[model samples]
Target: MAEKELLRISNLVASFSINGGYYAAVDGVSLQINENEVFAIVGESGCGKSALALSILNLHNKANTKIEGSIYFKGRDILSLGLEELNKIRGRDIGMIFQDPLTALNPLMIIGAQIEESLFYHTGMNIGERKKRSLELLTQVGIQSPELTYHQFPHELSGGMRQRAMIAIALSCKPSLVIADEPTTALDVTIQAQILDLLRRLQKEMKSGIILITHDLGVVAEMADRVAVMYAGQIVETADVNEIFSNPLHPYTKSLFASMPDAYRNARKDQRLPVIEGMVPSLLNMERRGCRFAPRIPWISDAAHEAVPQYHEVKPGHLVLCSCYKNFYLKSIPRRVSSSTLR
Candidate 1:
């Protein structure tokens, strides 16, 4: 049976004003997350991944940012909510694990106080209850000596511990939908794995839907149930995790896989890992129509691309944007290359 839908975003466009004109950073994006599901948004640095996440919570500066379209969480339109109404949902119903804990957490606030802050606003627990809950959360997130860590400020904790504390605060309210934006960014590999494992175990325990925003395909492979590949401020491909790994359709998606170090093996010692040519277009300079990925893969003929691209589901439950994917092939790798060959 299909899992219950937890959140839905439709035709969402998040644009920023620069020099009197608004340029879209997340354009015409739509997707849903189900209860207990991990929906990953993967892309390069400037592909609007974080912009989309911030839009969900209406966290951008309204004076300079323009957000259109509906963000429905449990059937209520988040865009339609006022500041007070939205505040009620922010920590209690929808938690966010920000990319950088050092910047996200309060420098002067003790670790325990930060976690208690969410509970204080969302729950009616008193000081004693709040402290107990805070310590429990810190311990839950794998921080040893929760009692001692509780009194320490953000600067005193190690990077991994700070990140764990961030997790504790996000999960303090046991929110129904958690948006973890680059939750493991800047952490060492060992700590990154531990954080990922903690998130997985906690999600299973809470049965909360997760929107994992990251560029790491490895993290997506390990944690996501469904994956969306974004490029040039739009989602170019989406599919089941297994399907995305087994059959990546979009040129951008294929290029991402090809760029991974593990994708190449038994190669000539001199052969370099393939790099996706060109950069993600700047927001103001982005092509508003046609195949957005065309400029990057110049070898593919324009005839293969749709003049006005739309999602084409080449397989059940797998959608690839633009018809160009049909004709896409790496100049280095031959056509009909199997997943094994790439891996």
Candidate 2:
């Protein structure tokens, strides 16, 4: 049987006006997240991953930007909702934990008060009940001494603690869907692992779907059931996490894995970490036709630049945007080549 989709985004096009012309930051991106699944969006900087997230929540000011396509949540089209409808959904139905905890939290507000505020606005709970629930949420997220941490301001709490508080706030209303955008980016490795574990636990307990946006493949590998790799404002590849790691088909996907710090370090003794050759092209110059990555493909001919390749299934349930390049590149070239061999 087919799994039910909790969220479905199709042909999403978003743009920002810069200088004198418009730039498409998210171009015709489409994907779906099933209930009780962790879907990840991975890409380098300026790949429209963040833009896609913002579009789903209707966070971008519509007056200044143009957006098209559908974002359906729970059978309703979110893009078609009015301000009041969206307000009712945001935080209550779909919660978000942004990248920076300090900035996301109010410095003057107590952590407990911050979480309670959501209840105050969204629920009819009195102050005492709100506080009790807030503490429970804080404890649920693994904060030690919830009472003590509750009284602390954002500054008094450590980075990881603040992040936990942020998570507690997002989960205050028991939202059905959570969008965590690089929630662990600023934390240490140990804290990152803890936060990921907390999210997994919460997802399982609440049966909520998650959209996890991050550039870290390691995080995706650990947390995501399904993965979408974005480049130049488009999804270049998407598959199950195991399929992505074992058989990444897009050149950009392959390059991203090759550029990982661990992979690069292991591949060479003293060279700088492997890097994709070209900078992401300016969105202002983005073309509606053709693959946006063709310019950066190492040796592909100009003909490859003429059109965007239709997404192809290399295997059951594993979809890639470009032609299969692993056989052409991986098998033809030795895994380890000496400098003399290149010459």
Task: Assess each prediction's global lDDT (C-alpha) against the native.
Answer: 0.92, 0.87
Write one digit per residue (lDDT tens) for candidate 1, span 1-343. Answer: 6789999999999999999999999999999889999999999999999999999999999999999989999999989999999999999999999999999999988988999999999999999999999989988998879999999999998889999999999999999999999999879989999999999999999999999999888899899999999998899999999999999989999989878876434664756667777788999899898999999889999999999998998887799999999888886644445788775
lDDT of 2 by residue, 1-343 (tens): 4878899999999988787566889998989889888999999888999999999998997766889999999899999899998899998989999999999999999998899988988899998999899999999999889999999999999999999999999999999899999999999999999999999999999999999999998999999999999998989898999999988888788878877777433556655444566688878765567767776665666654435567888787778775534432321223356787784
User: Model 1, residue 21: what's the lDDT?
Assistant: 99
Best prediction by TM-score:
1
Once fitted onto the true fold, the runs of candidate 2 whose alpha carbons sit more than 4 angstroms away are: 263-274, 304-306, 324-343
Per-model clash counts, in order, read 0, 1
Question: Residue 182's C-alpha lDDT in candidate 2?
Answer: 93
TM-score of each: 0.95, 0.91
Q: Candidate 1: global Cα-lDDT?
A: 0.92
Single out the weakest 10-residue window by summed lDDT for candidate 2.
326-335
